[model samples]
Target: MFGLGPAAKSLREQEEQAITVPASKLLLRAVLNLVVAWFVFDEARGPMAWIVVQFKPSLATSVESSDTVNVVMNLLYYGPVALLIAWFFGRMGRWPLVWRRYGRPLVRRVVDAIGSRSGAGTPGKAPTGAKAQGEVVVDPWWAFRPLVGHGGLALLDQETAAGRVGDVDHQRLNRALECVRDYPDRLAALLDAVREHGAAACAHPSGTRDLPGRHSGRHDLLLRQVRLGSAEDVPKNPAAYRGVDLAIDPALLGTSLLAVGPAGTGKTRRLARPLAEALCLQALAGTAVVVVVGAADADLGPAEWYDVVVAPGDPASRYGLDLYGGARRLEEAVARLADALLPEELAPRAESARQALQQVVVPYTEAYGRPPGLRELALLLRGEPVAWDALREALRAGGGLTDHQYELAQRERMHGQVDDPGALLADRLSLLDRPALAASFNRTSERGGGERGGGRGAGRPGAELPLFAMHALDHPLRVRIAVPEHSHPEAARIIARLAVGQFLYAASTRQDRSLFAGLVVDDASAVIDVHSVRSLQRLRGAHAGAALLLRTLMDLPESLRTPLFGAVGGRMAFPGIAPWDGKLFAEAWGTVWVDERDVTRAPDTSGGIIKRSWRAVRTILAGERAQTESVTTRRVERRRWSPSDLAQVLPGGHAVLSLTAVDGTPVPPLLLDLQG
Candidate 1:
């Protein structure tokens, strides 16, 4: 106390003197101004007095007397005016002392709370008494409580840095989060606080930079709003990374990706690699299902037929092909599948083992003009099992049979030829004595059988029409029956309709994998009819996502476009080598169409002469850019170049990608590999 005695006394004296100084001066100024104003406007004054006298001569004399009295009274008015001035000075004096003691430290705390960094990054504290424009002061606890209620929000106030973390009624904040009707209103207070405190001190950055906005946790989720032209131009190589190709990250948001290109643009070949990869992934995971649906069953023919006899080990296990162990099991499963999925009348014919005897017995009797011997017919009916070995042996014997005898036999029948007449005759003469033929003894057995008769509507009776044959065995995963190339467009449409039906049924019936990974229908426009395409509306109802591929944007009829094209969640495009169609597709998908510009030094050449390279451009469903080339000839004998040629000449896969989200957000540059 002694050490501070002299200094403390001096400081107190200075403070008192400083307070009185402003008070004394303001009082003097107020009194002087009031007195001056009163005298100058006195009753006998020069300018105003003359005007009043002239307007009313009689009252002018009387007014002069009253004015003198009023001047005196105005002097009295100066007393209160002086008091007000003193009061204002006194208030101003108090503020300085307060700032020196408590105010400076508060300001320091605020500045320390917020770092120096700007650009709306990081958050910092606002100074005490710092206020945003139009923001009213309210209980800070009210603001803190609502923010905390959002869950996962860290309470970071200016005082937090000063070790003064306060309690917020988190329950209220959580309620707000659960019922956030007006996001802008809900975030208004927080955004105001952020602006005052600066971004560095705020718990979260406002999403907007130029203005205030609330940012979500996902930084990668950009809400970039932009106006897209009919055709948006893209870079040839959007992704700078060479080897690391950008692919559909299955882990991210689900998508409906469309891959479009003209015929022979390597569309199928490009997809084959990914298809194989997808199949491999499914096989390896043992959880995914792969279903291939296409028209001609030739690709699956080996699985249906050869596997029955050879019982071969997994032929292409890497590619996920597993054959059934036995023909009976396969047939039974196929039958079960047909019964469960198809209408009752459309089931495939199931030939019993007893009916197989007609192949040998009828042939001998019909052609040789006699019935096959009883022993031969009996042997054929109750025959030794015709294993692969026996069939191979029969082919080896020179009596018009060999390992490839059946195939050769089929070819001969197709060409209406036969061999070994004598041997067939000997066998046929004895068939008349067989007990099985007793009822129809007079009628000669016909070797060539008519088409199996069954079913109506979808399949006609005795028409020998190709039918969808799906096996219902407990497949390890899923299976898809595809539309064949030879199938009529109508048939393909029906198949697609059935495909959707299958997905819906599976979704409703099975709890496991209820959400299909995705449905990818290629060349959809050519194959799917308007009604069938419209059926896509019910996809989500069926709990399945679908990605459809079309050749051109025009391929989809206007009626179907409104629903099918409009409903897509994402879009991608690839321009192919055709000027007209390619440009149309490009414009439809909103991708920029870049043509080949010859910026060379030819005297006759225009400075920026661009070649009308492609006539048609194809866009993937996702609106990603792809390059398609066209063949243009100067004359009949000129060279013909295809899209493949252009693709090869293109500097880095020669593709452009346009991506738009359901919310109309423009996606940044990305590369979709359409290569094998």
Candidate 2:
């Protein structure tokens, strides 16, 4: 899908076809020649002698009509062969390919003998070295993909025909491409180093280092920014930013972005789709690791851009989620899963829920060597006596348990007797254990693909389906996960929350901080909470980032409104949001010093006799009072974007976007024309 094969084939055919003479032109020439023949053989001079005498004085003699007939026949004898010559010219470009494919095989011995003496000359074949030297650069990125040999040169011709390549870049890229042609494997080694050591792979400059100036090792790529739209000339927008190009690159994304927009305000088209695509390309360049989470129907990007597509909502999905988020310690497992399952109102009981999950999870893992799946955990939490009895029996059968583990397992049998928090946690697990997601959460069924016996499928080898675990992203990989938002809103929320918690846990504990890891929660109403917001504050320092998309500011709790806005560096507000939501955004954007002009007109009071008499006369004549005008200008503090402006003044297909670079530089909010 990425290489230059199709373009090369077109170029090869174009080269073989030397000329393109349309059949209509040939047919017109034939008709005209036939008309000439008719006149030359006509009885009257109906123009035959007149037209012929213009070019040939012999026809003017009119001596011997048979002699004239002989001359006309001689001239038009080769007329049919003219079409033959045109056809040959069109097919001439294929001779080299024909010789290479067919002629070389029949007489290999003779061709080799001739080649041994001619040094480099061949009838239709170009020597490998000369072909490499003839390589013309089509795209600078072609060199990064290492498109070498005749295919590269052929694509150059194709690009010229398409008029997409300029002469300047063509010449400049050729100089860079020559270095790749000289040492093809060297780029492969350098790319390996980049994938291993992050931006430091390009720490030093070499004799032939050529790439975009905006790229460093941390977020290097053939292109720098992925354009989203442009800032328009509007009163709300700063004059300095009007008609300016707006884009988001990895450097800006490194600080994390928060996009707040309703469903159809081009959030998916303008923000999510572009960001996901950019991150996918960066992943291919071996510079970033990305995970995009969205609804099943959201058009974030195509599935092909991702290495693993974990569509938990789609029954035909080939990947399953690791319910425990790859946590090793038993406490870590209980804490992470409990955070995902418990309702927001029950957040105060988080510690109690953890204790309840630990009561069953520790014993289950002690017995089965892996954490409990959704079904097992749900049944255990339901306070079913039979399920607990069986689990306790299984834990006792395993004699490998230590005194503390066995003691904990024995204590599990009394879960119902105590005021267990399992009831609260079990109420939330009902969403995961639904019929639609029967084969989803546990991830052990064959339909769910082969899973290894590890803690929630983290780096589990020999699995047919991939597991969505951030701890396993030591290498560059792009993962896209889709949750069922419409049919199962609550379930989608639980999964979205789980994915975010998993990402935070992994990012906080990752050892190899080289790969710039990023997560995009397209609909984050279920994910962002008091806990996740706190974790997001540390993302900038961790060299990781996230893009949280919310439909409105009201999705966040009242207490979390300011913190959520403060935790992110890049912020956006799509058109048509509520005035209250815009108020929060206005407060977050803060105030700006504006030049306020005030013009007041007051009556000329206490004037001279002439002025008073004139004012009286003018008032009497015009039936109005006379006044003097006064103008005042001063710098005053005002909202950069007022609540009313953000709510109603923003035109359709426009959004207010602000940016923060990875190095902490800020750009004030400006109105972006999404269509532009």
Candidate 3:
């Protein structure tokens, strides 16, 4: 029954009508009682008549006179006998009312004693009240359900009232209780404790563990509980509910973290900054190697923590990213660079450009025994004979180049076609030629004066940029590269793409899974592509992870969004999200069945009129009676948190975390307020 109208009337109104009898119903009940009384009297009258016959034998001889006398005597006996029987039956009809008024409390007290002794108390029992040892005070209604058992009520209360336990923990506790019940000694001790105090008395102390500066274990980077939301009434025990502070285990993070939030929502300050700081602490302790990529103008915490700051196009920066430093082989480096410069949709052109660039790169490396910089590569693509002597010497020493190779190089030199694929690639890469940008990549030294021919120079093998070098993952290194997208959007994207590709390649090469690595990219939507998606999918196995911050998913191509969502092991969504994004999260969290309680009330007017009426000598009494009933129903496959609720209802500084469990199941979405 559904209660869907005005508020309920008071209890006094209900009780007043119960005692006052209704004239019509009372008359009907009285008549029925009189009929039952007559039946009772008839059964007893036969025996009485026999006794009378024994005393007056002469009266028994005359049948007609005896029958007449008997009828008269039976009539005389009806009033007293019937009246007495009717009163007795009337009392039986009121037994339920009597039990409710006087018997229930006595029975309830006995049940409470049994419940307390068994480590389960009544619903009204206060948690702070003195409970018997090992007694678990819980909602009595929950205890009646076959599924809930004794401990389930306590777990449910913790989850609903205190928010101390989660669904996963609830299931675990159920299993643990089952195990404890199987062992007599342990079970006895547990019950004793529960009876002595209440269930909450056994809860762990409310405090968090101190995070060490460094940790050897890969999974030790923990998100500490900074604050709690004012709106949340749930009391939390830091020790008991460790999941409140997210633990980004290496396995979970290996796939990646996708954080989506609007600007000025503390995504950077709360999520990104804190995560970076935690990673840096691990780096300082020599546990992990971290790379953070963001705009040059953004404040990404302390600079001292970073071993190298590579700001492309920032003349003041001390380090630069070598585009070719990602791979040991020249072909691999060229392919990776081409992927960064060209979108996958331009497959034909991208492939042609990669092949054209590799032809020059491979030949040049063979000639000069070193990789060329952006400047040297540009010259070669333009058909300049800058390294002709080195080429000729290498050719002579290697017993001469094939005629085809020589002809191709000579014809390119002679023609110098501007429309060539190699030239097109060079044009796209020309951004690196800018004075400020080129200076960063031109030298291996702190300043750009180490060589005449840029960082690697001719015949001088250059050290790989830390971003790509194999050894970089082995050390506690922090590499921060700033690409100011506003001034140089293409350059920023190219650098970001290259950094991501290099990290992915390096991650795939890792032999030791214990050492963890991570890449943090702020405003990543601008740079995410097919390669980034693949990298996210593969990173987990290599003990490498990524944290990508995006303002929205609108910039992402529709085809890539699903894969991107599937690839990341965790997602955090802040308030003010678009409806579509909220829907995605809603689906990720999925649906669950929940219990819904419906209460209904109907007017009950069964009581008769009272005798105390006066004004005009007319009787007056209460007109309506209220009857209430409760019914529970199930809501199956309903979304746990609706999209509209998440998009608009969540307060500022709050976000929902949908993290993947190690078992590959999605954990239910949890509401978290980082700024709390």
Alpha-carbon local distance difference test for all models = 0.35, 0.67, 0.60
Q: After superposition, how far is residue 646 of candidate 2 from its true place, in Å?
A: 0.7
Give Cα distance to truth, residue 499, candidate 2, Å: 1.1
Global Cα lDDT for candidate 1: 0.35
**Candidate 1 stretches greater than 4 Å from native:** 1-244, 251-253, 276-280, 297-476, 487-493, 504-511, 526-543, 570-572, 575-673
**Better model by TM-score, 2 or 3?**
2
lDDT of 2 by residue, 22-128 (tens): 44543444444444444434433335445556787774454466887767744554344444543443232233444454468868978787878766564333344
Q: What is the lDDT of candidate 3?
A: 0.60
List the candidate 2 regions with Cα displacement exceeding 4 Å: 1-223, 326-330, 400-402, 405-414, 417-419, 443-466, 600-629
Name the weakest run of 10 consecutive residues (lDDT summed) in model 1. 305-314
Best by TM-score: 2
Candidate 2: worst 10 consecutive residues by lDDT?
Answer: 204-213
Backbone atom clashes (below 3 Å) for every candidate: 67, 4, 18
Ranking by lDDT: 2, 3, 1
